[model samples]
Target: MKRAAKYIIGVMSGTSLDGIDIAYVKFNQTAANDFQILNAITIPYGKEWKSALKEGFHLSGEKLVKLDADYGIYLGKTILKFIKENNIEKVDLIASHGHTIFHNPTENYTFQIGNGPQITAITNIKTICNFRVQDVALGGQGAPLVPVGDELLFSEYDYCLNLGGFSNISFKENNQRIAFDICPVNIVLNHYVAALNLEYDNKGAMASEGNIEINLLNKLNSLSFYDEAKPKSLGYEFVSETIFPIIDKFNLSINDILRTFVEHIALQISKKIESNSEKTMLVTGGGAFNTFLMERLQSHTKTPLIIPDENIINFKEALVFALLGFLKDEGKINCLKSVTGASKDHSSGVVYEVESSKFPFSR
Candidate 1:
């Protein structure tokens, strides 16, 4: 008989650089298609780590290698603390999304740091990390990996839209799962807000106060990425190289920039949430908490937006990475070719096992 696995810890760091979200999930395969999210938590990144990660784009060679190893060590220690604090006893494995540094699938390269060996070495627990490299190597976008989770775990909604550093949406179309990045969200929003000495624009209050710059809004809305086809994704590099320069050219006030950019985000997202027979959309991520952005989305679309409990809103990505790990462990297809434009559907993640006396660890 095949025994069921019960517990796992999933870790994720979004491009927004908001924080590292660690979710302690209890997954049970009740039936062929049903699963449950038992419990979860998201730990905000400290100022020091946040700054270091923000600067990761400029790092290269030895500096990047050292940062990767250091970040891996930090992740291992953090997982240990989370395990002890939660009194979680039956953990099957630790699954991490790591921090994405470079993701240009066009060049056949994508990197997410946080070494699996270091994690297992520190926590003495089986670990699964680096979920994206293989998919990208297979010529996929190496992104929007959460669609598999969205399809299996939250299929109840007509559309699953995640408002993270970048906004991405997934849904069923012609009996196939379709998804793509909508536009930059917190990645650009936070950049400008940080200049005001704020970590984030709480509830988008600052944006709500600022007046929209019509010309800037028009220029932003005209970005070419918006018209791109599905199986696409976005990264920090796009924002730093493309978005920042456009926004900087205006020399506008921070408030005006925030307001106009918020509109741009809302407009881009609204275009993707196409009206359909099914009217309900499930929305999650840090941007979901942005009242102004949400209002803008709601204003433009007739579809009803459903925001679930705080746990689901804040830690859905972390929870889904847990599902990804579970699927990988089961040898089930966790990465979808339809979503990532991979050559084929595949199981992903490099696994590391802890050294244990009773249950021998696998290399």
Candidate 2:
């Protein structure tokens, strides 16, 4: 069977609550790792929605269920509006990495709210989502799902590091993809900056202006998470419980806190890559735009950090989620056992269909 091009709308909302990124991408089987981004936009969350989502992690049972469905509806409506605004008439599928509410793979359960059924009903389009549950059920860390994309699409780079809500790195070693969350990035950074009434420290200027608190930096560097082995991840729970309390005890100014944390991040990340023979590291995600952070990172390691243009930096995860969904659609291996510590490599994600749509690639 000859398959035509796959036009997938990839939607993602990271833990940082930065925004909802929706990318209209076209994938061609014949082109091999080639995909075209026809249209893409990031819709920032309003204050109310942002607060609601931030607090969603604490919601229980019925309230949590309601939040899941409501968030799904929100995502669907947002996707529809994006299509309308972009005049996008053709779409094959919608692949959404819904917002993570609870991610404790140690307990063998992870939840990313935004119900797939609601999305299909609202959009009248086939959708793929809930990508992590199955992997966790298989006794895996159920994270760093982007490694499959890094392997299949961006294999040229020696390392693929994403500086989003969390700093996670992916690379190949011994013919297997190795990846894990290095440290908290925008999630921690944005939380402190919010106190200053700014969404983010512009180009790390505030950090550059302040002196690094050595005691705070040393304590941060000695966190248990850094000493743990790979196949691990971080979540909002860890940040709120472990990180916030520790940082608060110092009573340092925001700039000092930011400066010390940035150094901590750079050190933690550099430690992982310092011994590697591979020298080219492709850096993406929101943190890559932080000039001060990048400078500190570069100073820590001699490895050449390659930052692509704004599009790749901002939307790579959304782009990779699209590829993951595409792999699931094709019944191919979308999750790696080595990277995620899963029992086996498997195609992950729940596929939902809208009856009798005009999708030429319908399975």
Candidate 3:
């Protein structure tokens, strides 16, 4: 008999501490490069959870472990609630791109908390998570893993750029997908904006008022990460260490800082897009909503930029993570060797199963 289609919930919490994006998808393997998104939803993080995750990188070993377990259980409960509300049935597994904590691949250590085992135990569902560790272990950046999804799901776009907590772009070069983090986005923007007791620069209004600090802009545009080659990724540590200090030196107002950083972001992103002029680029993620930033980028590049629906822009990463899980469950290569600079294309993520018979979780 033919196997039934698999229903999976893909969970993701990006570096911006935006919240967990859970996508409930029914995936069918029609062909190698064909798949569809059935249904999806983004769950906003509560204040307490957001605060805890924002400071997660500073926690100690034991506290971090506790947070991991607690967060996992929280995710499980959230998933169960989502399923009930949506009336979803026949879920095969939960694929989670847990919140990234420490991502220093040069040190040979990377951690994405939200314990998968705890998730399975609480939800009584099979879980697949920690998608970055193995790729890093094989001497890769352990990031920008969504390119495979971009490749398969939206292959028509010549370039796929996501402006989430960080700005990263992926595109075909000599028949290979090359992707890397361009610059910090909301992670840095939100940090400064939060100091003003605001959550974010809604619609980029605050950034639109202030003048760009030419000195700060020049200094930011000259950062070493910009000079680095492709297949590289960035983490929170880079911002805390390299970006924050420089921005802190100037005693500028919040709006000025926002303005300068927005320009810096536009400069970095446009430079990459200009490097190739042959095709249309699909841009998504939270930063895509930043009108000022988008305008700045448009000023610098000549290539046509296409912004999809709000759902696709917001949930693309989550949708891609769901695709990652589907590929992993089928023993297919999900991690792109070209994008991550891994030794080879590999299936990444650890599967955890709950020791329960009540929920009837099956593939």
Candidate 4:
């Protein structure tokens, strides 16, 4: 089964509702760390699709199941279009990080939509997904799975922090890699920006234009989650039940809310950095694009945040999930117990294969 390289499609849709990220990658079959993103894209979710996923948080029973299958089909067809448009001639596998619908590891349950079998059936390529459940089953937090990627590929940096829907960081501490969510970032910021009938706060301009409310800032800084130990994560439930209510009671304008929250995010993240000998903090994900937020973050810490090229910032998680899927296919451990608190380091993901193509175009 050896080959010079493995061509994989890594797909990711975070809780931020940013979009589905597609990364066509090539990996050295013998050296896992050697990789390249041959092509990548972020397919913005249409209005109807976005609204459906937003409402899916409250769905249950058959409604939830239907959304899962529908999303899988959507992903499958989307990948096919990407392949055609790029004139991609070879694809051995697809590694999809399905959108997180619910992630409450304490309750021993976490679900990501986009069924793997449906993807395999539609695309006729081996598909690997459902990456978090096994770790949760092992009494782990089932979160910050990207740390495995950090340990394997980006170990040169002292810290690998991702500011996606929720902000999470990974770094080597003592001898083991440690990681956990710091606070809400784009997820909280985007929610309030929607109030202004906009998709985002371009360059964080609105946040920079307003004032930070001292009272709101203090309350956000004092949330219990900030003081919690490592191996933690945040979900939409935390925002809907905890963050939004706190911000709404103050009844501040979206500008002020964004301003205060931006400061709060910066402060929480600053608290995590200890002036270390190795000072490079690699920042990635959609939040890295927020100019004002980055400025605020710089003011809070001296660790020197390093934001890589746009491709890495936008699609690192998708790239990592691609690595995770590849590791599983290779029968190597992709989930780390140190980062996830799992029972043991293990490869986690369900792989699906198909014998024939039902897709419109044949390979």
**When superposed on Cα atoms, how far off is each prediction in RMSD?**
2.5, 3.2, 3.1, 3.5
Clashing pairs in 1: none
Q: What is the model-wide C-alpha lDDT for candidate 1? A: 0.88
Quick one: ranking by lDDT, best first?
Answer: 2, 4, 1, 3
> Candidate 2, residues 244-330: lDDT per residue as tens digits?
999999999998989989999999999998544457999999999999999999998888999998888889999999998888998
For each candidate in turn, the TM-score is 0.95, 0.96, 0.95, 0.96
Expressed as tens digits, the lDDT of each residue in 1-363 for candidate 1 is 655756888999998887889888877677534555665666788888898888888899999999999999999998899888878787898899999998899888889988889999999888999999999989999888988888888888999999999999999998889889888989999989888788899999999989988988888888888787878988888898889999999998898999999999888878887765367899999999999889998888888899998888999999889889888888899999999999999999999977657756567
Residue 60, model 2: lDDT of 97
Clashing pairs in 3: none
**Candidate 4 lDDT over residue span 1-363, tens digit each:** 777788899999988898999999889866657899999999999899999899999999999999999999999999989999999999989999899899999899999999998898888889999999999999888898999889988998999999999999998888999998889998889988887778889999999999999999999888998888778878888999999999999988889999999999999988888755458999999999999999999887778889999999998998999999988998999988888888899999998977653777867
**lDDT at position 78, candidate 3:** 88
Winner by TM-score between candidate 2 and candidate 1: 2
- The residue ranges of model 3 lying beyond 4 angstroms of the native Cα positions read 1-3, 32-34, 275-278, 356-363
Query: Model 3 scores what on Cα lDDT?
Result: 0.87
Worst 10 residues of 3 by lDDT: 29-38
Candidate 3: clashing residue pairs, number:
0
